[model samples]
Target chain A: MAERRRSEATRQAILDAALELAGEVGYAKLSVEGIAARAGAGKQTIYRWWPSKGAVLLDALLAYTTGPSGRIDDVELPDTGDLSADLKAVLRATVEELNDPRLSAPMRALSTEILADPVLAADYADRLETPVRELKLRRLRRAVDAGEVSADADLDVVVDLLWGPLRTRWLYREGPLTKRYTDRVVDTVLNGIRRW
Target chain B: MAERRRSEATRQAILDAALELAGEVGYAKLSVEGIAARAGAGKQTIYRWWPSKGAVLLDALLAYTTGPSGRIDDVELPDTGDLSADLKAVLRATVEELNDPRLSAPMRALSTEILADPVLAADYADRLETPVRELKLRRLRRAVDAGEVSADADLDVVVDLLWGPLRTRWLYREGPLTKRYTDRVVDTVLNGIRRW
Candidate 1:
């Protein structure tokens, strides 16, 4: 138990150091040596636990967001039975998370770097995107099952269409990602785009 | 006129060569020397005409998309004034342009690189994003003026909301950017998400 505690503490230190360094230097310049020195752990410790710097950072991000719970464990779409309210609640939390100063730069840089290197992108998708996507899809499917969604609706399109505006707002930084905007987005996707 | 023709030819050659090499080697590997060699022009010719590689590529992308009319001159967003149809039409063209083999890979690499590097990112916004965004805004404004859209609506939000899905689709290779998808987006934005 003592050895396990030491190992866990060392792991957290590495992740904290990596997150700080990734934010400071951007992911391209983040190095294992620098991370090790910053964390006060041996370089071999990091290598033993994580396969790559990307993995370390990914794990860090997961831990940072999830708190004591493992990634994807505690987070769930609001299930108040009203889809709009539920979606807005979830998206509002996301807006806060995206704008969180602790997370904003490193996450953006990591995502940006992944885009440049296609190989890392797959890992990024698996580690980050897929879980979130699956969670959202599951919630939307529940809505569909409950008849909150149109019977003929395509869940995949529903997913893209649901998140598309929010994605645009965050990625482009072109407009405010206010609750009002999320509300409108939720409203627009649920109803058809045609005029009554 | 003869001397002017010579200058124009040289400019065209430089741009053509830059685009070709950007595609061939990826943006990071492309250089002024490669562009000059491919264009059969002197290095001084490139240096005299353009300030940087980003500028050269931007001009090339503009020319490729808009021809000699310049980036904003063509104004393809039809004022035929049926806002939904007009929006759909322009988006359909954009989908084709984005999917075109000639434009996809290098453009992706450049966008990816800019995401990581702040300096390159500013250039990208200046050379590509600003002009395009301005044009889209104008098109939306014209629609508002013509009574096709809500006069009091937050036009900026609308523009971001409209393009957000399409951009995500293209950038992430999320799904087929077909006419159907484009039409659905146009419909979604014009109408609200709420069920009547």
Candidate 2:
């Protein structure tokens, strides 16, 4: 029990250091040595647990959003029972999260890294995207039960319509990702997602 | 005039070499030296013309997709007097483009490279995204004039609705990108983009 407790603590420290350093230097300049030094853990310790810098950053992202438990399902979406209001709030919060320098830097790094590595991409989908997507769908499912959304609405399209634009702006820097933007997005897509 | 012609030919050869090498080895392992060697040009020659491998690949992408002139506006979208048919056809063609191994490899490389470099991302937007997006919106605007779409519909949202989901599938590899898939996207979003 003591050994397990110490291991968990070490893991948390590494993830925490990763987030800190990634934010400071951005992902392109992020180094495993820097993470180890910040965490006060050995390089071997980090290597033993994670496969690559991207893997470490991916876990850090998971832990940052969902806590150290690192379960993607643990990430929450608010359901005040109004689908429109709930979606707008969630999207606005995401805009704010992306605006946060500390968080966005690491998130961007992880996203770029995953683009080059197919193995890491699969791990990201399985560990992060798949579960979080299901959870978002769960909230939408609740809305469907409440008769706010069309029962026949394709769940995948609903998810993409609401969230994909956010990703595009984030990745491409196409436009300002603002509350107004997300709000407009929600307002526009609401016509598409909800029962007509 | 002869000197100008020679420079243009050299530039075209370098861009062609970048695409060929990128298709073979992907962007991560691609090097400027290898490209110079393949193009039968000096390393200094490549550096004199293009800033980096990504820049070369970006121009190569522009040329391959839109021909040697590399005018994003010149990349055409069909009208055929039907928004639904035009969009479905375009998306399905995009699906085919993404599936093409020669094209997809370099496109993915450029995308991943842009993620890591802010300057490159900005150039990508200005040189490729902005022009192509405007061209796409031009096609949609014709729909508005024809009374096929509502005048009040937000143009940005309309662009994102059709294109953003495709980007999501492309980047995340979340699902199989297929004609059936693009057709459904057109069918579903048609409700939101067009009138009730």
Model 2 per-residue lDDT tens digits across residues B81-171: 8888999999998999999878888898888888777899989989898898898889888888887777777777778888999887887
- TM-score, chain B, model 1, is 0.87
Off by over 4 Å in 1: A175-184, A187-195, B117-120, B141-153, B191-193
- lDDT string for model 2 (A75-141, tens) is 6689887778988989988999999989988888788777777899999999989898998899878
B73 Cα displacement, candidate 2 (Å): 2.7
Best-performing candidate as measured by lDDT: 2
Error of 1 at B84 (Å): 3.3
* Candidate 1 reference-contact recovery: 0.43
Give every candidate's TM-score on chain A.
Answer: 0.90, 0.93
State the lDDT of candidate 1 residue by residue for B1-196, as single tens digits. 9999998998899888887888888878988899999999999888887877877887787787778866565554676768888888888888887787578766775666556556766766776777787888888888767666666566655676677777887777656879888887777567644433
